[model samples]
Every structure is written in C-alpha cells, then in structure tokens.
Target: MEILSTPQGDFELSRFPIRSKETLRAWDAADEYLIKVLHEEQLLTSDSNVLILNDSFGALSCSFSATRPVVVSDSFIAYQGLLENLQRNNIDQNNIEFRDSLREYGEVDQPYNLVLLKITKSLAQLEDQLHRIRPHIDKNTRIIASGMVKGIHNSTLQLFESIIGTTTTSLARKKARLIFSQFNPELTPPQNSYPKTYTLESTDYKILNHANVFSRERLDIGTRFLIENLPVSDHYQDIVDLGCGNGIVGLMAASANPAATINFVDESYMAVASAKENFTKAFPDREANFYATDCLKGILPSSCDLILNNPPFHQQNAIGDFIAVQMFKESFIALKPGGELWVIGNRHLGYHVKLKRLFGNCITVASNKKFVILKAIKN
Candidate 1:
C-alpha cells in the first residue's frame, strides 16, 4: 500500500487485487490535482452531496469518505478495491453509497452539490454518464473532471460541451489536466445510444453491447478468430466463456454443442448484463449462468470441462499481461482433469508461454498473421 497525502488527510491506498511487487500506485497525478483543487478552492462543503464517477480505485472516494459520497462505477474489481481501501483506512462502510453505471438515478432524492468525474478510455461510457448525471445537476452544480493530458483531446472536450454545458480546462500539472463544465439547465443531451446491437456475421444471433463493453461497435478481430475455431463437442458438458464480453463466443459454442451448458463471466456489470441478454435472446429455452466477478473467484474447483477465453491484456488504463496471467491461473484451477482451456490472443502477447507454465502443456489450435488460437489441457 502507498500513502496518498492530501489536504484533507493522508490515507493509505492500493489498487484492487493487490499484487506482489506492484509498481503502480493506486492514485495518479489527476487524483492528486483534483484533491488539491477541492481543498484549495474550498469547493467541498460539509453539507455537499458529492457524486464521484469512474474512480479507478478508491482514491477519490476514500479521500472524501467523510462526505458520504455516492460512488458510481461499472467494474467489479474497482468496487472491490474501494471496499478494501475503505476498510483498510478504518472508514465507515455505511458512510458511502455505491451504484452501478447501467441504472438510472431516479431514486436520488436531491440534486448533487458537486460531481467529480475521472475521464475514462471509453467515450461512449463518458457520454452515457453525462446524460445520466445531467438530470441530477442544475446550474449551481459544480462539475469537475480530471485526466492525463494525453487522454483529454478535442473530442473529449467537445463531448463535455455538447452534453453538460460550457466546458473549460486548466493548465497541465504533472501531465494531468482538469476540466470544468458549468451545468446548463436549458441544454438537452441527445438520447442515449448505448447497449448497441449488431448481428453476428453469417448468423442470425444478435449481439448486444453496453457503453463500456470492449469492441461494442463490432466483433473484435481476436474474438472473431476464436469463434471460427471453437472446439464444439458433446463431450464437453460444462463450458465457460471467461471474460465473456457480449456472450457471442459462448453463444456460438452453445449453438454447436447443443447438450452442453455454458457459463458467461465478466468483470464489467454492463458486460455481464449485455451477455445475459444476448444469450437469452439467442437461446430462449437453454439454461446458462452469468457472473460479474473477479476472474472466477467463487467458481467451484475442477467444475468446468472446457473454458473459452479471450483474455484482456489490460486493466483500466494500465496495459499489461497481468490480467491474462490471473485468468490463466484461475482457468487451471477451475478445469477438471482432462479438461481443456482454449485461448485466442494477438501473437505478440505470448500467451502460450503462460499457458504452458500453468497447464504443463500447450498446443497451437490455429494461427493467422495477427492472431493465434491455443489450447491447454489440465492433466
């Protein structure tokens, strides 16, 4: 854990699923800048009902835990981090409220006094958030957003202006910038176009994707490659789609293996919801399990006969193979003896090495110039 020194107070913080020899700090320059500005400018009042959006860890929420802020995020891992940090800091769990990003905020009783937004990689998600929070703010509400300078661009600023109101930015400090958007009471944002739908190629299946889901606009090349090479068979009675984005991979596997039951799992609440919807729409009579979890943490040991995965190489903004490593380890434990784990990834990721290390053997199933499909058996 690292100490985040802020004007309010210094708090110990760490990223979710704390790793050994972790090099990344939980809070970033933008988090520090936002905290500094809040205290220096006297933006936060004791009675302020603050709403924090997209706090990667618990940095913002933990720093302002005394305010009893309402925190909104779509990531299960992020939520876990927030809870862990709050408990580690001895903060009262009841002091804060948590909400998922997919739902509307009609149940909120009063307008927010302040809204803190941490810009994300998904522009669609940011747009959807602005539309959702628009009704909860008024002309008096203070809207402040922060991100690394590289992450904020003309398109990002334009999104703010089009959705919230007149938007402005601050001088960069430590490569981090802050955005100030005045809530315009008269402006009506465009209708939310999230949960996009598209038909899978050469199939009648309709795939539904939420705003934050990866490759929501279309089938990502890696996933498309994996789908074309699925090892569908009746012998694999139980199957799992690890990191199942919209359930297309699992849906296709189920289509070919009619007698097998498929399980769809992803960390994103929105992704799981989309997958659940898409799977149900495709097979109304078939039964399946959907989980929004941290990489099969609660799944039964040696329960799955086959696991299909297109492991993500990054977690949030930090890009690495740590997520894929974790998924492989989990797949190893969840697979029964003689069970198989199939993965498709870019050739540069070197997933075969990790799969070999965990499963003791790995074989190439198919390959193209950019992507490779590999299979490992738990023997």
Candidate 2:
C-alpha cells in the first residue's frame, strides 16, 4: 500500500472491508490541496485546537497531526478508515479524539482556533454541524472547508453564511474549492428539529432522519419493496437489521415477530439516531439494540440467527458494491451455524454472485422487474 504523505505524517490508508485491490484511495486531491493551503498559510499552531469535520477517511485529520486535532465525521466507514490509517502508519491513536456525527458537539468545551470542514452533499447537515460548532469559536478562529467543485454551490455558501459568517471560495485546485469563513458573533442557531414524519400506504412509520440521512424524503423504493415482501419467520429468535436506515426492516421484523429481539445497526449516526426514534415511535414498548456501527465490526461472531439487510451500494460520490459485499461477508462471520442472511438489492447489481461467494448458497426469495430479494444461509 502506498503511504499518503501530508503535513501531519505519512500514512497508509484503505477502504473498509479490506479489499486487496480498491479502485479508489481514501485521500483525494481536495485533501492534498487543503493541506497545501494550510501549510502555505501556516494556519495551525501548537496552541491551536482544531476540529476536522466531514473528513472522508481521516485525510485532513491525519495530515494535520502536527497539532493534536479532534476529528468529526458522519460516515462510520470514514471513522474506521481514520483509526485504521492512524494505526497502519503507527500514529498514536490517543493523540486525536474521534467524534461521530450522532453525538452532541457541545461536549468539546475547549474553544477552537481552527476548524477544517469537508463539505457534504446535505447542506442541512452542514448547517447543523456549523451551528453546533458556533459556541466554541471566537472571532479570530479560521474555518476552512473544501470539497470537489461539483459539491460546492450557492446554497453551500449560503449555509456557511447563515451559520458561520460571510464566506468566499478559493480558486479550484484539482477540481476542488475551499470555503473560508470567519466566526459570527451573537448569532442565534436555528432550533434542532428532527424525527420528521412521512405517511405512506406501505407503512405509517415515522422517519427519524437527522441531518445526514439517506433519502431523507419519503420511503426509498428498495426499502418499500423489502418491507412489502418481508419473509415470515416462525422459529428465528435473534434478528439483525443491517444498514437499518430509519429502522424500517427491523421495525417491520419486530412487528411481525413480536417475541423476537432485533438488533438494528448502521454506520451513520444520523441513520442510527433516526432508527432509534422510529423504533421508539413504532415499537414503543419493545426493547432492542440500536447502534451506530461500521457494519458488524463490533458485533460478536456467531451470535445472530437471522440478518436482514438492504446494503448500500455506494459511499459519498462513488458507486460500487464494496460496501454491500463487506456487509454480506461480515454478516456471514457474525451469524450462527445455519443462520440466514436476507438481503434486497437492485437486480442489475448482480448481488447473487456476491452472496454466493460469501455464503456458499444464495436463494432468490422474491423479485420484481427492478429488484431481487435474496436469502443466504451460513454454514
């Protein structure tokens, strides 16, 4: 593996699930440009406490190791990548504190002199993160956020102005632009509103989308199909809803098998938070495990009897089956003997081959013209 050299240090990085040959690297040109600007400007100091947000793979954080930085991001995979990168390069993990998007930001009581922002597609989420960081900034604090040219928009600048202060973009470097902003004093943040409701004939489940959830609108079509055709289980006692966005699959499973305990897992804090809220609203009296995890990373092996997943095929701006493949492979490791893993995916993705490779047997349970639901049993 090639080491990514930055101002912080040189480190090796890889995509999650440990593919032998990944088409993409964790760091990008935008990351390099941001580090270049930071170095050229000498923006950070030993006394400077930095908050790095939306760092896709700890590139910004790892690059800025000169000043012990605190990293915050929405993606659980990003978080995993950061830690693994740090460990791979022999960077002291204790030097940086990693915070996920699910937790409250106010916990960082120390004032921040610098904040490195990485723009996400969700402007609402970016605004919320900025609003939460407001209380910790002083007038002289410098906030530098960057993203690919395609992600920067007028609304992106507007959100920065609303939460931080007036902003301006730098010239594009490697097709990326940086948004520079000053601290805004005496600004009142908008109310933190969440757990949005969406009513549909398929299910009356309330969507608990935080700032950075997937398809925060109505029900996603794949989820709708999975919910409509959920399998009936008579003997399964333990269940897992992998990538349980808004807890739809686990919610439905709970409703069908009232006696079965379900574990809802997703890497996104926003998704898990929303799932928790939906679980509370839908299964008010039921008890279950809801966690913001990187797939089944923290799950004990051979503990689950059944796993239902609508695995994501993409991460950030890239589209691929690496995530889904990892989830299936991980599910196989985490399931008990004879335990079954149920999944739904777009037919064009050819998830059947992936599952067959992992589970040794894959069966098509249901299908439509666009989607196919498959079930694979652990040996």
Candidate 3:
C-alpha cells in the first residue's frame, strides 16, 4: 500500500474496495502540492473552517481533520475514501464536515472563511458550484484551487475569474499546479440552472442531471445491462439503487416492482437530481426516496432488504476496486438478516470474490462474455 505523507501526518490510502494489483493510491502530487503551499504560507489554522472542494481521496481533509475542516466534494468515491481513510488511519472524525456537491446549496447556512478547491475534469460543473457559492463568499474568503498540470486548462483559469476572482498559478511540482485566487467583492455570480435533461427511448423517460452526473448525454452500457437483467424479489420491502447514476437501475426496479419502496442514492448532486427527474417521469404517482450520498455511509444499518449496484471501477484517472468493495461492505452492513444485494459488473473486475467475502454467499445471477450479474445474500 502506498502512503501519502504530508506535513500534518501520514495517510495510508488506496482506491476503495481494495484491489490486488492497483497502481494508484488515494493521494496524488496535486494533494501534496496543495498541502505544501498551505503549510508554506500557514493558510490553515485551528479556527479556520476550510471548505475543501473536489478532494478525490480524503488526502486534503484527512490530513487537516485536526483543524476541524469541512470537506465538500462532488465525488462519491472521494467522500468514501475520506471516511475510510480517516478510519484506516485512526483519525477521529469529530472535526470533519463531509458535504456532497449535489446538496451544497443546502449547506449555505454554514459559513467558511477559507476554501480549498481541487479542479477535476468536470470544469463546467465546477463553474456552477462556484456560482452557487457566490452568496456564501465574503471579502476575507481566500480560495486555493489545485490540480495536475494537464487538468489546468486555459478555460479553468477563465472560469475561476468568471466565478470567483483574479487567479495566479503556482509553478508545477510533479506536474501539478495550484490556482490561487482572492474573492472579488464587486462581482456577483448568478445561480446555475442545472439538472440538464435528456430523453431515453428504451425506458421512455426524460432524465434530469445535475452537472456531475456520469454519461449525462446518454446511458452507460453497464447500467443498461443491469436494467435488462433486473431480478424479481418477492421478499424485498425496501430497495436501493447503489451508484444509481441517472436513476436508470432504480427507475427500472421501481417500474418492475411498484410495491417496493425504492431508495436512490448517489454521491453526485447531478446524479441525484437526474434520478429524481427520471423517477418522476417514469412513475409520477410514486414517491421515492432519493439521496446524494457517499456510497452508503449515512444509510441506516440493517434497514434495506435489497441493494442494486453497477459499481464504478475508477475515481478519475485511477482504476481499482476499492470503491466497489466499500459499497459491498456498506450494503452488507445496511442489509437486514438474509437480505440480498444484486450487482452487475465487468467480468474482468471479478466482483464475486468481494461479494462472497462480505455476504457469505455469492452467485452468478446472469452473465454475458464481457459482463456478469452477481448476487450476494446476507446471512
């Protein structure tokens, strides 16, 4: 396991759901660079309520948890990593504030003096987040956003100026650069009209997405397979669509099992938004529970009867099974006695072993050459 050592402490991080041969750890050079700059200038203090944006892993927040930092990120996997990493390193979570990007508008009541922004591939969505953050910004609020050199495009700088303030770039260290910006008191950013819509003919519904939803333009193939191979569960009282991107699996589940109450959960604000819209369009009369969460972290234990997942294999550029494993563990914890979890995944990923370990029983419900639908029954 690769440990990311920072000035604050050493963090042993991995891509969620552990992997046998994964090459990437949770922290990156950008994280190190960000921490370096923060320490170099003493930007972090005990009283500072730092809002960390887009921390891919808990690298930034975990190191600064002692400072009572509030972590705000758009990635479910990243949020998951933060919690697991905090646990893995034995860091008390009393000071941490985990805020999902989708529900960021909800946290406007809490004011933060300093914010740490880490730019990702979703720059367009980042712009919207910044705009929403305008009302929350004050004169003393300083933002330091960083990313790998490749992630820092000209438009990234332009978007910072458009939404936050004047920007300056730090020299690249290990191919990562930081964008330092001060809030512009004169500029007031407008509200973003998100939940972008796209219609799907197969399900015959129009999906709404917040900016961070995956494959917002069209459906992903893994989800299509899961929807096609959905199981008929007579005993399922409460069902959850884990990583319910765009709400496709959960929507299909609700359509098939109208009697069951479906809970749709995702980390992305856009994903939750899209799922809500799709649910309304697909089953307008039904009221379903939808949440933008970091995996199943906040879900009540031993509550759900069934969980459906099309687990993601990567968080950003790093490819691994850490996330899927975490989801499996969470599902097991959240499931009632004898409850079941259904999942569809690329066969190459071999999710069966993880399921077997967590649930004590694993079976191949259905399979194609490239993909397999696996089921785990909680014992």
Candidate 4:
C-alpha cells in the first residue's frame, strides 16, 4: 500500500479487512482534495475542534489528529479501520472520538467548529449526516464536503443548500470536487428522520431501516426471494444471519426455529440497529445477538449450527464478489461441523464455485431466473 502523502502528513494506511493480498491505500483523491482545502484555508489550530463524517478508512481523522476530531460513520468496519490507521500512524488513541451515525452523541462543551465530509453514495444518508450535525453548528463553523467528480451532481449541491445554506463548488482537481457550504442557523433543524420503518405484509411485521442500511425502503428482491425459500429444521439450534440487513433473514429463521438463538451480523451500524429493532418486534421473547462487525472476525469459531446469508456483491459504488467471498469464508469458520450455510445471491455471481472451493461441496437449494439459493455444509 502506498503511504498516504498529504499536506497533513505522510502515513501508511490500509483499508480494513485487507480484502485482498495486495493492500489498497485507505486515502483517495477526494481525501487529498479536502486535505488541500484545509491547508489552503488555514483551518487548523490547537483549539480547532473538527467533525469528520463519511471518512473512508480514516484519512481525514488520521490527517487531522492534532485537532482531536470527532469521527462519524455508518460502517463499523470503517471505524475499526480508522482505529487501526491511527495506531499505525502512532497517533494517540484518544486523539479521535469515534461515533456511529445511528447513535446519539451527548452534549460536549467544545462542539465541532469545523467539518470535513466525504460524500457517500447514499444521498439520503448525506442529508441525514448534515441534519445530524446542524444543531451543533454556529455561524463561525466552516463545512467543506469532498467527493469524486462523478459523485457530485446538481442534487448533491441542492442537498447542501437545503440542509446547510448557500453552497459553492470548487473546480475539479485530480478528478475530485469540493463544496463549501455556509452554516445557516435559519435552516430548520431536522427531526430524527432516519431509521425509517415500513411493514412487511407477507409476515404482517414492520421493519425499521436507518439511512445507510441497504434496501431501506423495503425488502430487497433477493432477500425477499430468500425469505420465501428459507430452510427450516428443528436440528439447528444456533442460527447466524451473515450481513444481516435489518435482520430479516434471521427474523425468518427465528420464526422457523422457535427454540434457536439467532445471531445477526453486519458491517453497517444502522443495519445492525435496525435489525435489532425489527428482531425485537418480530420475536418479543426470542434470544439473539446483533453484531456490527467485519465478517464474523470476533465470533467464536464453529459455535453456530447454521448460518443464513444474503451476501452483498458490492460496497457503495464498487461492485465485486470479494465481499461475498469473504462472507462465505467467514461463514465457513463460524459454522459447526455438519452445520449448513444457506445463501441467496445473484445468478451471475457464481457463488457456488467459491462455496465448493471452501467447503468441498455446494448444492443449489433453489434457483430462479435471476438468483440462486445455495447451501454448503461444513464437514
């Protein structure tokens, strides 16, 4: 991995989970663009309290460690990566305060006076983040957002205008763009408009979704397909829902196995949170564990008797099978001998081959025109 060399400092940063053997640097051009803006504007001082949002792999926080920035993100994996990056850079652990976007941050005497935002793919989430920090901002506060040129658009600028105030963009530099938005106290602060809830008519149950949770509006087609074909058995006592968005898979599994404990794991804090809410609503007297984690990293090996998954083939705008492959690998580690790992994924992703590679066997439980449900058993 290339050492991130910016005006702030030169530090070797690697993304969390090291998805592949060839490590990719955590920082990007947008990170550089924002770092440059902060330097050119001379926004730093010993007392320059800062809030960094949507920071992927902690580039902003690592660069602005001297400011004791508050780091906010929806991805627990990103937060963990940030901590790892800070440790690598020899920054004090206390220099950065990590906050998950879904949780509340209590009152602090010295609120953030500066904000560095990395535009996320989810515009709704971006709006929510801006809304979340609005109340703490003052006239003197400076907010600058950065993203790749391809990500910024008219709607992006409009969101800034509506949430913050008048906004202006900088010329594209190194394929990245920046927006400077003024803090307008007149902009009516938003109510907690996140963790949106909707009803699943099939089960007569309500599902809650936070801003960054995938398929937040409703049950995604793949998961819906999986739910319709969920494997049920009385033999499996502990079930794990890998990448459990809103815990629907686990909810379905729990409904199938009344005596089993369901474990819901996902990288998104909001997803885990929404899953917990939905689980409680779905099964009032059930036992469960909701973990916002990176591919079952801390889960006890071979502890789960069965694992259910709707593996994500992409993260943000980048599409690939790496995430799914890692999930399968993790599921293999977490499942007990003779236990089953059930998953529904796109037909084109060829998950069966990967499962066969890892578990030595893969069986198609079911298949539709666009998706396939596969079950792999641990020997």
Candidate 5:
C-alpha cells in the first residue's frame, strides 16, 4: 500500500488479513477523499479530538495519530491491523486508543470535535453505531462519512438523515463520495434493533445474533442442510466448530456427542459473544470453548478429532473463496490424522473439489437443491 498523504501526516496502511503481494489496497479512494474534505474544511489539527469509526485498517488512525484518535471497529483483524500498521511505521503507540464495536464503548466521556466515518458493508451495523453515538453528538460536532460510490445508496443517505439529521452528499471523486451530516435536536435517538433471537424448530433453544453476523435473523440454508444430515458417531472426542456464527453446529455436536468437548471459533467478537450466550442458554453446565480468531490459524495442529465448518466466502464487501480456501487449508493442518472435516456450502462454490485437493478424500454426506454437505478425512 502507498503512504497516505494527509494533512496530519503521511502514514502507511495495510489490509487486515495480511496477505502478501495482495492486489487490493488497504485504504480506498474514500479514505483519501475524506482526508481531502477534512483538509478543505480545516478540521485537522493537533487540538482536535477525533473519533474514527469503521476504519477498514489504520489509514485514518495512523494519519491522525498526532491527535490521539480513538479507533472503534468490529473485526478483530481490523484491531490487529491497526497495531501492525502503526508498528510498521514505528509510530508512537500511545497516540491512539482502540475499541471493539461489539463492546458498549460508544458513549464517550468527552465529546469529539471531529468524527471520520467509513461506511461498512452492514447497514444494520451502521445503524447500531449511529444509535449508540447519538448522545455524543452536539451542534458543533462534524460527522462525515465516506465510501465507494457503489457502497453508498439511497438507504445509506436516508440512514444518515434519520439518525444524525440534515445529511448531504459531495460530488464523486475517483469513484468515492462523502456524506456530510449534522446533528438534529428533534430526531429521537435510534433504538438498538440487534442482538435479535429466533427459535429453531429442530432444536429446543433459540440462537442469539448480534447485528453483523451472517444471516443473523435465522438459520442459513447451508447450515440448515448440515444440521438435518449431521453425522452421528461415538468415535469423536474433541470437536471444533470453525467459523461458528451463533454456534448452532457446535451446540448440536455437543448434544449428539455428550462425551466430547466442543470449540467454537469466529473472527467477530459479537459472534463469539453470541455463541457463548447461546451455548450458555442451551446448555449452561456443558463445557465449551469460544474463540474469536481468523480461522484456525493459531490453533494447535492435530488437536481435534473432528472439525465442522461453514466458512464464509466473503470478507467485508469482497466476495471470493480466499477465506474459505484458507479455512480448508487450516482445517487440514489442524486436524489429527484420520480425523474428519465436515463442511456445508453452496454447491456452485466447488468446496468439494477444494476439500478433496487438501484432505485427500472427500465424501458428499448430503445434498439439496442449493447446498451440499461434504466430509473429508485427513490422510
């Protein structure tokens, strides 16, 4: 990634996942456009107190490190990227503060003079952020949001107006646009609509979901297929739920295999938190491990007898199999010899082919019109 030339200072940026020679740049034109708007509006200063929301990486934070900005984001990888990128440039670590969006840290002790916003893929998440930050904004606070023109939509602007009041837009530059919103005294603070729960007809308990988890409202079709066809065996002891969203897979695994210990891992703090809540609600006395991680990257190899996965094909706005392929590779590396890796995916994704390539053998456990449940055994 190129060094970002901002009014505060030029700083380097990197993507969260840390892929080498990656074609995608960490920060996009929206980031640069936001900086330009800030400079034009004379908002950047040493005395300015800044709160940066949803900075994909550390671009905005690093650029404004002098003002000691507070950075709040949802992805654990985004938090890691902030630290790594700050270290990459040898910037003073004391200049920035970090917080996860899953936590109740939106209410600030002191009001911020300037807020830089980068709209994320989840409008639910954006609404939640706006709802939380409503009390913190005043007449003097400047809230400016920027994103790719493709990302900004009519509803996006409508959200700004509904929450922050009297929102407006800027001319497109380099395929990016800015939204300027001012505080409205009349609009009521938005209510929190997330952490919703829905019951599963197949199960006795309901699953909880935070705003941004995949298919938060209900069971996804892929996982739904996996559940109806989940293999039952007494041979497994240690089990893992890779990319466990609300931990339905691991919970079901636990119920089926009473003697086994189950581990649930996901990158989102909210997902892990939701999984933990659901696990406790479903089986309070049952022992389980919930981890927030980037796949099974740091998990000890050959430590599990079975791994169940419904890996995501997308990371933010970009859709591809990079993450799912990486998850498959990680599962292969982490499973014990002769251990089973079970997966549920869309048939068109060709996950069976990739699993066969990595695990040496793949079996179609079940299938439907749109999804296929496949299993692979470690060689």
Candidate 6:
C-alpha cells in the first residue's frame, strides 16, 4: 500500500487481492493529475452530483468521497479494491454509490455535474460508456478524462468527440494527459451495438460478447486453439472455466461431457453476463454456475475435478504475469487430488515453468506456432 496525497485527503491505497512485496501502487500518475486539476479549479462542490468511471482502485472515488460520487466499473476486482481502500482509509462507503457498468445510466434521476473517467484499456468499453452516459449529461456537464500518454491515441480522442462532444486535451504532466469533452446536445450519438453475437466456428452454438469482453469481435486465436484441444471426459464431474471469457471453453467442455457441471468464472461482470447468456442460449436445459470473482476465491478447496484457464497476462494497462501467477496458484488449490488443470497461453509466457513449480509436474498437451497448451495434474 502507498499513500496517495490529494487535495481531498491522503489515502493509503493498495490493489485488490493484496500480495506480499507488491510493487504496484493502486493509483497512478493519471489519477493524481486529475485530482490535482479538479482541486485547483474548484470544479466540485458539496452538492455536486459526480460520476466516476473506470476508477481502477478507487483513487478518484475515495478522493472525492465527500461529494458522494457514483463509482462505476465493469471489474469485480476493481470493485473489491475500491471497497478495501475505502475501508482502509476509514471513509464511510455508504456515502458513495457503486454501479456496475452493465447498468444503464438512463436510470439516473439527474444529470451529472461532473464525470471523471480513468481511461480503460478497452476502447469498446469506453465507447459504450460514452453512449450510455450521453443521455445523462447536458452542455453544463464537465467531463474530464485522464490516461497515460501511451494510452491516449487518435482513436481515443475520436471516440470522445464523436460520442460526447468537442474534445480537447491538456499538455502532458508526469507522463499523463487529461481530456476535456463538452457535452454537445446537438449530436445524435450512434446507438450502442454491443453485446455482439457471432457463430462459433465448427459448432452450432453462437457466442455473445459484451463490449468489454476480450475477443468480442471474433474468437481470439489463443482461445480458438484451446477450444480445439479441450479435454473432455466423463470422470471430470465438476469442471471450472477459470477466466472464462464468453464461457466458450466451458460451453465446449459441456458439449463433450454432458454429465459434467460446468462452472464459468471471470472477474469481469460483462464477461460473466455474456457467458451466462451464451451458455443459456446454447443449452437452455442445462444448468451451470457463473461467478464474477477473483480467480477461485470463493470456490471450495479441492472440489474441482478439472480447471480450464486462459490466464490474462495483464491488469488494465500494466502488462505483467502477476495475474497469471495468481490464477495458477489458485487452480492448484481448487483442483481435487489427481484432477487436472489445462492452460493455453502464448509460447513466451513461460507458463509451463510456473505450472510445474505449483503442481510438481507439467506436460504439453498441444502446441501451434503461436500458442502452447499445457496440462498439470494435482497429485
């Protein structure tokens, strides 16, 4: 945990699922830059109705807690992080309202005075959010968004201008930049065409993906490789699709093992929702469990007969193997004795070494030029 000093207050913040010797801070320079600017300009008042988007770790929400801002995000982990940080800072979380990104802003009773967006890695998610929030903002609404220099591109600015209004940017500060967008009531923003559906190749099932879902446009190559090589057996009764994006892996597993009860899990609410919808559409008669949680956090110990994982290599903009490492460790704990954990990842991620270290043995199940599939048995 680190101290994040802002004009509102000094908050000791840490990322969700806090780890020992954690090097990453919960807040970033972009978060600090936005808060500094907001404070200096006196843009907020006690009665101001504020909405904060994609606050990865509650930096903006906690900073402006006094205003009772409505915090919105699609990530379950990020939601947990915000709660954890708010508790750590001894702030009354009851003052703040938390909303899932899937919820429509049309339900809001009043127009927001200010909207602070911490630009996310998914441009689709950003675009969807802009469309959703468009109905709730007027010309007087102040929309300030912040992101790292590398994250803000021409496409990013284009979305703001096209969807919101006339958008501009501030000069870079500490490798972070702020975006200013004025609400243009004249513009009729395009309707959100998200939750897209596509036919799964070689199968009759169609997959539906929310805007923020990974590989929303099509089956990503890595997942496609995993789908082609899924291990299906009658002995695997309780199978889990860890990091189940759109629940395709689990759906395939279910197709093969009709008797097996599939559990679809992912941290993204939108991902889980898409998975549930896709699964229900594919197998209306079948029953499965879905969870939007940190990998296997609430799962029973040694209860799963099989676990399929395509671990994410990064959290938001910061790319690293920390998330994959955690998923591997959790998979080991969640698997029953003699059960198997199957993983497919890029060849360079070195997942075999991690699996061998955790499960004491690892074997290559399949491999292509770009992706490799590894299997580890919990003995």
lDDT of 3 by residue, 1-379 (tens): 6788888878887666466776667778888998998899998888886777777778888888887776777766676777788898898877787776765542565666788888888766777778766666677887888889998898989877877888899899999999987789887555565657777656557777777787776777777787888877678779999988788889888878878999999877667877887888788788889887767978899999989998877667765787788899999999999888998989888899888877778999888878899999988
Cα lDDT listed for each candidate:
0.92, 0.82, 0.81, 0.85, 0.85, 0.91
Off by over 4 Å in 4: 19-23, 105-110, 189-192, 316-318
> How good is model 4 by TM-score?
0.96
Residue 358 lDDT in model 4?
Answer: 99
Residue 258's lDDT within candidate 6 is 94
Candidate 2: which stretches are off by over 4 Å?
A: 7-9, 106-110, 186-195, 199-204
Misplaced by over 4 Å in model 3 are 1-4, 9-22, 75-77, 87-91, 104-111, 188-193, 202-204, 220-240, 260-273, 280-311, 320-379
Candidate 6 lDDT trough over 10 residues, lowest sum: 101-110
lDDT of 6 at 125: 91
Say what the RMSD of model 6 is. Answer: 1.2
State the lDDT at 93 in candidate 6.
87
Alpha-carbon TM-score of each model against the true structure? 0.98, 0.91, 0.72, 0.96, 0.95, 0.97
lDDT of 2 by residue, 125-170 (tens): 8877887788878888898988999989998888778778878989
Q: What value does the lDDT take at residue 116 in candidate 1? A: 97
Model 5 residue pairs with clashes? none
Candidate 5 worst ten-residue window by lDDT: 102-111
Candidate 1 lDDT tens digits, 1-379: 7899988788899998988998899989999999999999999988998999999999999989888999999999999999999999999989889998887653565889899999998889998899898889888899999999989999999889989999999999999999999998788777888879999999998889999998999999989999899997778999999999888999999998999999999999999999999999989999999998999888899999999999987897878999999999999999999999999999998999999998999999999999999999999
Lowest lDDT 10-mer window, candidate 2? Answer: 192-201
Error of 4 at 1 (Å): 2.6
Better of 2 and 6 by lDDT: 6
**Clash count, one per candidate:** 0, 1, 7, 0, 0, 0
Regions of candidate 1 where Cα sits further than 4 Å from its true position? 106-109
lDDT for residue 323 in candidate 4, whole number 0-100: 86
**Higher lDDT: candidate 2 or 4?**
4
